[model samples]
Target: MAKAVSDSAQMIARMAPVLDSQDYCFCHVADDHKFHAASVLATFREEEGLTLVLPLAQAQAAGLAGPAFRRITLQVHSALEGVGLTAAVAGALAEGGIACNVVAAFYHDHIFVPSAQARDALSILQRLSAAARR
Candidate 1:
């Protein structure tokens, strides 16, 4: 089994960010709507409702006109105890005037940025990794 990385520097250096082709959007469903686990990427329960990260087409079909996003998966097996990766990523995107929504799964970290700025976000992440390699 692959071991998880906890060191911040190692995580940054190894986090090879790959931008997904599919555009996605966040939707809030409070009613009795059943979204298949396979259909949606991820879901979070908040005080108000359940936030679902779904593909763009699915969201559009459901009549949602929210902000679209592109996912950038940080291909590093980071431990839950890992530090600084999210902060560094968020800080970098903030400097670029892009908002970031991060979902830290068991394996890798997924970053969602505005669809229009997907390429820009990917470039920023690549540069971040390269800099960590220096």
Candidate 2:
């Protein structure tokens, strides 16, 4: 089993950033819309609808529309019980005036930022990690 890392500084210092190529969007699919394995990155049941993180092309094919965003995976193996990593990472992005939507999974944290700001976001995260190492 992979050890969960909860230390804020270590999480930051060890964070290896990976930017995904495909554009994505949050979409709401009616209960009747059949879900295909390829269309979804993540899903959540909501009172209003089924919320999903889906690839832009797939979402568009399903009749959903939205601005395109890029996915950035923080390659640090963040334990689900980790503390402060989200806040610290979010703070850095906030300081850079970049908006981020974060999802914390069992092994890693994913950040979705607008496509226009994706590179900048990655740079900011890299700098944050470098600073933490000092």
TM-score of each: 0.96, 0.94
lDDT of 1 by residue, 1-134 (tens): 47999999999999999999999999999856787779789999988889999998988998764899999999999998998999999999999999999999999999999999999999999999999999
With a 3 Å backbone cut-off (N, CA, C), the pairs that clash in candidate 2 are none
Give lDDT tens digits, candidate 2, residues 24-128.
989887767787966589988888888889999987887886988999998889877878889988999999999999998888999999999999999999999
Off by over 4 Å in 2: none
TM-score of 2: 0.94
Residue runs of model 1 more than 4 Å from their true location after superposition: none
Best by lDDT: 1
